[model samples]
Structure formats: C-alpha cells, structure tokens
Target: MSIDTAPEPGRTHDVRSADTDPDAGAVAFRPAFRAALDATAAAGVRVHEPGTEAYRRLSGTFNITKAVRPLAVVEPTTPDEVATVLRLAAVHGVQVAVAGTGHGATEQMDDAVLVHTCAFDELVVHPHERWARIGAGVRWDAVLEACAPHGLAGLCGSSTDVGVVGFLTGGGVGPVVRSAGLSSDSVRAFDVVTGDGVVRRASATENPELFWGLRGGKGSLGIVTAVEIDLLPIAQVLGGAIWFDGADLPAVLRTWSQWSSLLPDEGTTSVAIMRLPDMSGVPPVLAGRTTLCVRFAWTGDPEVGEEMIRAIRCVAAPLVDLVGPLPYRQLGAVHADPSDPMPVHEASTLLAAFDLDAADELVALAGDASGTPLVMVEVRQLGGALRTGPDCAFAHRDAAYQLFSIGIMVPEVAQGVVAATSRVHDGLRPWSRAGGLPNFCDQAGAERVRRAYPRGVEDRLARAARRYDPAGVLLAGRGLRTAADAVG
Candidate 1:
C-alpha cells in the first residue's frame, strides 16, 4: 500500500505510503493535512495521521475486502468538531469520507480524510412522543435496548450491530418491513454537517431538499451527526427461521414463492439457500452442507401468524422450526445474520417477478448440487407499506422481490466466488430489473449509483448536492460524481 506519486488535479489518489515507510507519501500533502490535524487538535478533537496506530485501527471497515487506508482518520465528539474537520479538509483541498461502524464500505474512497463518528454515541428515547434521537455512531442493538422497557421498537435492519444513521440514510428494510416500511420513511429529522462547514437541521420544515436526499441518498449529500425517527408500539412479533435439508429446497422454494406473494401486510418473509462452512458457531445439520431456510416475521395476531406459518411448514418436514412469539428485542434472531466481521463480496438485484421459471434458474445456479461457491443466496418478499412512502430519493418501490448473494473472500475461492455470483446475476436477468436497494448496493462507481435511483431522481439528487456540497468534499455515493461533473 504505497502512494509513490502525487495525484493530478481533479483526480483521486491512494493515500497509503510504501511498505518500507508508511509516511513516505505524506511528503506530497503532509504539510496541509498535518496543519489541519494541528488545528483540530487545538480545538479538542482527536486526529490520527497515516503512520499512527490509531489511524490503522480506525481506518478498517467491516467489509475487509474494501478496507480504507485514508490519509487521516478524525474522531469528532461533537457536531461542531465534525464541521471543523470538514471545513479544514475543504480549505486544504483534501477529500472527505465518513464512517460509523464501517459496515457499508465500498472501497471507493482514496486520497481522503476519514471522519470516524464512533464518538457520537448518544441515544435519547422519548417514549411519550413515540420517537428517539440517535447519534450517528449508535448501533441498532443499543436502540433496541433503550426502547425495550417502553414497549417501543425502532425500524432496524437484520444485523443488530449495524449503525443506525447509516441504515436509515440508505432506506433500511428490516424483518417487519412490509408492515413498518423502510427506516428512512420513519425519520422525523436529521442533524448534519454539509461540506460548507455548517451544521443544519433537515426535516419536513427545515432544509427540506436536504431532508429528501438524506433519507435515501446516503452520505453523498452530507455527514449526518444525529437523526430523530419515529418508533413503533410493537412489543413483540412472531418471527424466526425455519430450516430444511437441502433435498427439500425445490419443494420448499416453490411453495414459499407462491405462499409469500399472497401474504398480507402483516406478513414479511424471505427464503435463503446457504452453504455454510463447518465452523464452531454453525449447527451441525447446516454446517458444510447446503440448507434451505425460510424466515418469517408477522406483526398481527398470534393465531393468524401461526396459521400462516403452517402453510410453508407442510411443504416439507423441516429440520428445525424456530418461529414463535418473541419480544422485539430478539428481532435479530429472525435473520440470524453473522455478527462477526469477515471479508465478503456481496451483490444484489431487484426482481419484478420470481415465477417457477425463475426458481428453476436459481436452483440450477445455487441449489445443493449447483456447486456454486456462494455462501448465501436470499430472496426477500417486498410490497405492502414499502410501496407507498413519503417522497424521498429511494427508488425501485415497485419491485416485488430483492435477491442477494454473498461469497466469502477466501484466497482459494475468491475468483470462483466472483464468477459464480456473476453467473447467478446473469441467470436471473430476465426476471430482474435495473435498480436495487441502496443499502445493498456494495459496488463502487457512478454506474452502480445510477441503479439505486429511479428516472430523474438522480438528477434531483445531483441538484441538491451542488447546493449543499459545492466543493464535493463529502463524497459518499455516485450521485456526488454526477453533481461534480454538472456543477464544477
């Protein structure tokens, strides 16, 4: 990881210096970045340079394959500090990138100043008002814990460890998404710092354009300091996973595809075909073998939910059935996503339909005997409240299903994983559409960013970006690139 030459004007460069000396490349822009660091330190902010241990530790991301090595990593404890860092970065002509838990890293950042928001860990739950104000660094698990005693729940993603602000900014889809809608739709307001070094409040009544873009535009528009979102009164839900042997995949999938389509707004479901490794945390029945898992989350009556779940259960004798009434605090169990961080390559697409023909194609590519190196292939049923949300930048609201695939980035299987995932993407092209969920768009570059929004939505986002981030220092998604090209 070395930056042997200085970057040309208007072009990005890798900030990491050579292996022989981590700070060797600092000679290019060290004077300016160091000056910014000194100024921030004088203001009581903690800043880490490239060669320091803090910089190495804070620069790492959850997706190991896309770990960032920025020129500096700044930890801001207050909104004012965040504004100061952005202002200095702008004046010095250094790019800026922000991260919470680093779960959504796409490896697009280079020659940049990394703003790590882990220090902004604030959570204020207003039970009577039915809302909560959360800091950018807060995780969903913390929110759940804070809201549990009041019998309220926030719209959270599958993994509890994911950052709350990052998830909401990307239009979070959770287990009860069909009933609760996206997390972004629940947002009441956002407190953020634009690239101009001003802290502003965005909501229906204040900075309305920024509000619309922040809901689904991701970090491209600004750096979020905190967010206020409405909470549901749901104390419990009937949800969890049902597992079956690989041999039952075909029968189970066919039944699930039809049954899930007819489910009411109270029911949200997804089916996953997994080939998990023989690891310690994995159950023996599913370890080192392909298995079928049907995940269900129901927000209605217990009896009705049980009756609905039984339809899929009768399709085949399940190896395990874990669905039952549980407190919303245990919602993470429904998806059972991995809690540990590891190198992974993930891709996703939205589907207009998943009929029998599509199912057959998917089976041929990822089923038990398919021999694909993918670790998990999942299809989540979408619609209901999700189809109708307030105006925002999130697109593909009409899509009926979302297909996601994940492959471990192990050296022995990396190439196989990439090729297999691409084949799966190609196999389902007929039933798939051009766009997908923003939270799941893990690839870098402008083309991928274009797919996250609908027609004309990207243009509107670009207009908003030009107005808020004229310097283009707060780069997050591809929308900013379009804005820079048009406005610069």
Candidate 2:
C-alpha cells in the first residue's frame, strides 16, 4: 500500500532484525518509523523518540503496565499510515500494540511497535441526522463535549477519558445503556488496519464478518482509525453517587440489588464498596473509610427519573446524597474510578439475576463486616439493552449483572486478595452466568474468551481471523478458542 503524504516521507526499505542491544534496535527501525512520523507531525501527529521529552510525556500518560516498556511511540495521522505501521511490524516480525486512551491497557510492550492513535482525534457531530463520525483516538469527553451544543450524545462508558475504540470494542455498557444500547450497537462504520497490513472499512453491508468481530473483538482483530456511530438527543442526566457509611453497607447493597431489579429500562445503576485511602482527591468524609456507594443514572423524564432513583435511595439514609441533575461530562464522578494507575488485579463473573437470596450472599462477601477487602467489590446492574446484542458480532449480551472485583496487589496481601476474590466468585457460581465479560478479564486468555462469545459466534469470528491473519503472528489474546487455535 502507498503511504499517505506524511512530512517525514518515509519511503525506506524494511529494516532487518538486529542484535538485542537497545542501541542496535533503535538504529534498526527507530529512524524509519521516526521519518514516517515526522512526515505526519505537521498533520497533528506527534512522534515520541526514546529518551526525549515528547516520549516521556507519552509514556507517563499511559503507564498502565508496570513492567513492560515500549521501544518507541508512533502517533500516526491517517489510516493509511497506521496500515503501513502494521505492515512494517509484520514484515519485521515485531509485535504491534495499539494504545488509545490507555483506560484498559493490561500489559507493557517492550521492543514492540506502539501505535498511539491520539493524533487521530476528531469528533464530528451530525445533530439533525443523529449520528457522529469520530476518530478512533477520540475519547468519551470529546463526544460528550461536542454533542452538548446540539443536544446530542453518544453511548459512552463510565470514564469519559476512556478511548472510544477500546471501550466500544470491549462491549460498552454505560449509564444510558438501557435506552441507547451499547456503544457498539451505535456503530455505523469503522476504518481499521488488519493484521495483514491492509486498511479496510467495516459496516453492516461491507465486511460484515469483520464488522461483527471488531465491535467486541477487543483489539484482537486490528487497529481502528475512525468510526461512525449513532447519537442520542440527551442534554443532561439525572445521575451521580450517593454514599452511605460502611456500617450500613450490607443492608444498602442488599436493598440495591433487590430494588434495581424492579427498575425499568430507563434506569441504570450499580453498587460499589470502596475503601479509599486518605488522599488529596478524596473527599474528607469518605477518605479512609470503607463506604457503600449506590450510583444512579436515569435517562427518562426528570420527574420519573427522580422517582426511579428515590426507590433505592430510600433503602437507607445516605451520609452524602449527591445524585441529581448533572451534565454528561460529569458522568465519571458517578463511578469515581481512580484516574491514576496502580497495580490492580480485577476479575468479573456475571449473575443470572440478583434475587434477595443472591443479594444477601453478595453483601456477605464484600460488606464492611465481612472482612478487609483486597480492593473494591462492585456490582453493576446488567440486562436492559445489554440483554440485546448489538447488530455486530460481539456475544454474551444476556447476562443480568456483572460482579466486578478490583484487588490492589499490596505487597503482603496479594495472594489473600486473589483468594478472597476467587472465593466470592465461586460462592456466587449458582447465581452467576457461566462466562465473563471480555473487558473485565485479566490474563484468563482464550479459554475465558470462549465463555464471552457463544459457540456459533466464536466459529464465525475464528474464520474471519483466519482470513485476515493466516500466520497467527498478530495474535494478542484474540477471539480464538485457544492461543494455539490462532493460526487455524
């Protein structure tokens, strides 16, 4: 494929593999990639060289992985250039890891080609048509901010800083998911670079197989450059968090589980058990306390929304009732996921339903009186539009709820935290869905992914992978049944 008119004007021959020396590796491919990146630098693409100021900024902003270090970071300006980088990586036998906003980054990639798509950021609104064309590098913040002027919004996940591509690819379930469906469901098209180093467009009518795989494939298929999605007419949200003391956590959690079941599709909510350390960002009252937080988001009319949220709020008097009319940009405060990166070991299992019996059991596992938790134990309500799969290929949309546990691996208690989380998951097995969410898993690999996608869907996705990645060199924990099944 021909390169886009990048300022760096990279028209060099492929680099051959050299010795393991860092200097050798840098001399081998760094200059070529830099040239390509330089060509696009004038086009809003920023190239970060090793040991440079720009490189440090890029690395620090996405320090999601603790061990792995990228050789160099390349921010490509256009889809063609992204495809070129993939082709170059494949030719050089170098692994390529795509980084969006780094919200779901799991591993570090030493000596790998890191493509930071942030330079591709763009959010174009079509209010009258109720649709949007966004760059893959774009974040929920861009969509939320741009759509506000026209009274329109997209289905974005909890943290607005999360990249649109990464979130949507992992099956986005958000506050308004009940009404607008998943972020993937709103997808109209995606411009992506496949493992074969080709840039292709995926839509319902064109490349339908890939369209299905890419939606929930979780970066297993290719690197997306741009996407088009449907937008909703939403100016504001009746959503935020209501915090209760740790002592009232059990009863509050139980009541939330039971009460949320009766909620209509217009309502979305979740319960979190947070043991926040006393820090500058944390509220004084909530700092150093293990608190129970019930978060609510209602997309219906304001009057009915208040009534819907009131049902759960009445379960117990909250120490801090902060739920009310809020702008869409403030949606991150609802979940309050720490913006900083710390070592987090997360596991998730879905429940068939959260009946009263299940609720009691859930509260017992993570309640304040239960024991010291490794980290936060969150129960997010599922169903509603989540029960309905998007028009793409992602599977497992029928789960009732997702039980997510985040255990910080403190030096002395790492194993205990893992054990406690495992015990909790095992205890909830009877009420849990047989599988898990692709996004929530950490190192479970393809066996875990099989549970995420049903059998028929898995077969179809494998075929598409075979078509695009016949050699299996592009494998990065993809849609296959097993890691060994990658090349098939």
The top-ranked prediction according to TM-score is 1
Q: Write the per-residue lDDT of candidate 1 for residues 1-488, one digit (tens) a residue.
A: 11123333553433444654654356335677656656666767787765666777778788888887777688888899899888887887777889998899874665778889998899999999999999999999999999999999999999999999999989999999999997899999999998788999999999999999998898988999999999999999999999999999988898888898889999999999999899999989789999999999999998999999999999998988999997999999999999777899899989998888888888899998999999999999889889999999998888999999999999999999999999998899999987979899986657657778765788788888778887877767445566447645
Q: Output candidate 1 Cα RMSD.
A: 4.8
Please give each candidate's TM-score: 0.94, 0.87
Over 1-488, each residue of candidate 2 has an lDDT whose tens digit, in order, gives: 22222122233323423343232235336665445444434345444555455454555533333433566677778887776666666655566677776666655566565678878878788889999989988888888888888888888888787888888888788877776677798899988888777889999988888898888877777888889999887878898999999888877877787788888888888888888878898889998878988988888888998988777778778889999998776777788777776776678888888787877786677777777555688888888877775555566677888888878778787888889889888878889877666666555346656767777666777777777765543545343635336435
The stretch of ten residues in a row with the least summed lDDT in candidate 1 is: 1-10
Model 2 regions lying over 4 Å from their true place: 1-56, 59-67, 444-448, 477-488
